[model samples]
Target: MMGTRRSVQFGDVITGMLVDGVDGTPYVAATLLVDEQLGVRLEVPYITTSDTAAGETPGEWFETKCPPKNLLLIALEGNISLFDCRYSGHTVRHPAGIAVGKITPADVVLQDRKGDHSDPLEVKELRSDIDGLTEWTGFTAITRHPSVDDENRVKKLDIELRTTDELIWTQGQADMALRTTWSCDSTAEGLTINEGVMLHSTFPAPVPVLTHLEEHRKVASLMTFIFGCPITWRSHSVRDQRFTEKRFSQLIKQNTVKEAARPDPTEKQLRHPLASPSQIGSSGLEAWAASYETWGRFIHPAVSALNSPRTTLENVVVNAAVSMEAAGHLIGEVDGENATYDRRRRKTTATFIYRCLARTGWDWSGICESRVGLARALAKNYNTIKHYGRGDFPDPLETYLVSSTATLVVRLLAIRQAAPDATSEFDSGRHFPAYGRLVEDFKNNGLFIKCDGLFAVSS
Candidate 1:
């Protein structure tokens, strides 16, 4: 909680005593559970207290009867606070003190104090780590100091790297930077090097803790789209300028809670990222940041579908298609096209696909031989899945190819709009091996014929 640390995952259950944030009233025994679907919840059971001042008579009290106040759960693992809790339901009540009820919270915060504090902590800076960020950035923090023998042969070598902070983006008074840090350890067997990327944000003035966290999430979303994966926050902390005070808070939103920890992509796996450090350069990243402010509404759906671990093949196709359609309308308007771009009289999906492909100058003929055939196939498949309920879904293989193709198309369009000069690198097979392989897969598998009837008509 002080710095970067492992975050709690779903299905973790912590048992503790529940205390009311206001008036400091201790409630009955409770358990805090995080679920993939149900989200963060607290289960409290009725309790019988013999400390009644009225007499020797014991009374039973249901924690559910307590007012809807922010509650704190003190467990051995850590202290967590539940905010905006409401009574969900309860079980059988005949057992008096043993009946159990549920409380659903709109947000959950870890390592936070009792919620009665009137003055919230002001955040001067926020720092967090995302999975695979180090690899995606292609930055290193390790340096080798080698000592040679008298014969010029290597004798001893020491590895060391200093912590570095590089400015990535600045918007008015607020600026975002990337911090790379390394640690070295000498064990009985050998030495080990650990490196990571920390996303750092500094505000012009002390901002609300929630605002600091929102900024982190927004940047993480943009990185996810660029990296072509679910770049979830591994750990985070909010602190003052001098790091004298540190606070940890997590918002338990639907998207944040359901995110699963995916392993970082290996060097081989990252052979063809949608965007890279060398490709984006320093100035290009700033341009990308600016572009995201305007185009994020068009890009988020595609990013979510492509990166979500639980996304189905059908969802990938439908989401990619919808995102491309929306983005195409904007691109057309930006290019001063005469077509009226509106929801009521919308252009066909094929028309949008063609426009995006043309704008990016992406060579689609390698995949389908004919660009027209490819566009028609994608549009037909998308329309069948989205508009017709009776149509059969595409086979798993064809669906995968179509999803991959759409993802690449989206990336091309994004790069073109953000950093037009970098778009040429995507065409080189030597530069983007993954892109070449995808095209090769389409050629080998004959995706054109398969996608023609991607969604079969039901008899």
Candidate 2:
């Protein structure tokens, strides 16, 4: 046979051989083909390189097309692995704040280092105890770009982290992973897509300002809240006697005995053997009561009830002294001159206005200001105490002036920004003025009596 007569020999080979053309150009001798038993083969394919001549090279540039940098993947090492596998295509950049899906430690192995198969350098589970210097992989953007619609929006990001290790690959699974859901909290400042730029602008700087009087006002307000006394008390007793002179005497006698027996401090009774005093307003009650007759009618009867308490009178007196001192300090600080109109007659005239205020239970919130308003408040409280100073209201006479004064001084020190240092020497019992004496000469006497018999108040 002309084709195969015992395989007639020809000087020609097929695959991968270069044959010279008639025009003296070299060409591939064979084309690639696949067989069932053997895989498709790569014949001598053309390769373009920098060393190749312009026309002789298959192409001047090689094109490596890969997924955009935004595609994210988690390596078997539990790290994000980004592929810039694009040799040279279009220049794509990743945006900031882009995240990748779950990266488990089971999927990767570390390369480069030598280790046995039994303990190969493989990904490890996350632990609570990670050292500060330990290096762990996380997803981050390769580049940042602003959103077209909103500049704040993140345009693109390579949410995968890269590692020098093998990744766990399945038959058809893509290299990257996607996270469907996660939780996070919003911060006061908005987030940024780019690490270099902060998304939210900084808040305006605060204006320099100063005002300390407001603090003083607050202290005054709180003081009033805890210690305010009622402004007035209405004596609910009804006079039921018929018009008769001798009847008045019998009536007075009967009422006196009845009042004495009941021992209720609230009952309005004649402290003296004579006339009932006029009911005055809360204003100026202290001065009005200074008269022997006026005080005798209220004070004596009231004191009789107090004296009958069947308790330790010494404790009562000490407590009263302390309270009086405290009341004097507070009222004096606000309006000492008005607290006691005359310096010489403070104890006799001014007295502890706060004590009087406490006695009457006046609402102090309404009366707030420097001197005049405080004076009015004091007068109102005092008058209230005198008229309605009965019942379970706190008494200036019953509270210790030392304790009260100490409390007031402590409070004053707290309220004041710069206060003189307090000393144990000042807290001594001997240093405290007597309660009766302090109230008696509040207008005349100073806080403490000096060796020269002068009044001394805290600064």
Candidate 3:
């Protein structure tokens, strides 16, 4: 029976739940010491790249355990500040982009101390008092996730000797390979290993467990990236919005609106080209939300203002129409002579959707007002897009349309102009566009409309 200690030490036994995933695997957690002493005392030597050697004494470069294929080596001192794992991936080759969750906790174990395996007489357990402790501390520390084949299939075993001592084992290592049990035919078989198994007694007994944390850890790091820089969001926002704006600009240059780009002019299409235009509209709003949510408080006031009622449906329609026309004008100018009907006609067809939406009291003016607001919102969402200016706008426009099914704009146009009487089908709503399929359709039909339910093309 494990004895209860008055206080837990860095090596004290901790009981945590094991989260089993889709395979015959289990994740276990144990209290372990994490600090610089633990890093240095371990005999394994490591070389520090200049990028990671910040404010530290330069030591002789030593070949530690040849880094496991796809594994990164980390060094520690005597502290566990947020900085403990900060410099894990700073090299140009590794870049700060390396995912750190794939490395197993067991892989970070310390060799057992010769005679210190006994439980300490009086151990006081360390309690975490910091907010969001999960983000910085965990019994199972996955130092890094290397891009290795079938990384998920590997097993990691972390054996604790004390609150501050741990031994790590994995299947891939030679001298440190873990000893594992294979239960077959109701009989236990001796585990095979290339290296001698090293076991150590830790202050703690059962370990605290966390499993399937690779993806979660990546998410946490990404969150850190956002919190640390805030500008990354701005950069992405700039790229995405600029991408859209550039596409819009391209549409303006190309000018010709091909009929094929429009929704099939059938009874079904007349009612709901693309399919669920409303959902597409909602998606645009959601995209705006996702972009803004990542930036926190670092956005312009006008950018934040998108949440204001100025984004009413009326505003969306008006801006959408105007923007569509602007896109169309751009397209026409760029591809006026001998322009492929597929591309040019598609732009024209898209504009037609705006015209129909306007005729149906869908509020085209509101969309126009919001166009600038949308641009502002995008600028707020992404700073890079604003500064860089998208070289080409058509692609991003297509992305937005595909994501929101706004490309049903063509089908909507066919319904309004070709067969207004079939307007009742509009109630069916718009569906999201299948980008590949739709693009192909646009390319194939060249001004020919494929009529659906209510969107019959007359001319």
lDDT of each: 0.63, 0.25, 0.24
RMSD of 1: 6.1
Q: Which 10-residue window of candidate 1 scores lowest in summed lDDT?
A: 55-64
lDDT winner, 2 or 3? 2
Q: Would you estimate the TM-scores of all the predictions?
A: 0.74, 0.16, 0.17
Query: Between prediction 1 and prediction 2, which has the larger lDDT?
Result: 1
lDDT by residue for model 1 over 291-394, one digit each (tens)? Answer: 66577666778878856857887788888888788777777743322232235665567767767766666665556644555666677767767776746865
Clashing pairs in 1: none
Candidate 3 structure, TM-score to reference: 0.17
Candidates ranked by lDDT, best first?
A: 1, 2, 3
Model 3: per-residue Cα lDDT at residue 423: 37
Q: Backbone clashes in each candidate structure, one number apiece?
A: 0, 38, 99
Candidate 2, lDDT over the whole model: 0.25
lDDT score of residue 148 within candidate 3: 35
Decoy 2 TM-score against native: 0.16
lDDT tens per residue, model 2, 277-364: 1211111122221232322332222222223345343333333333334445544444334444445554532345343334322232
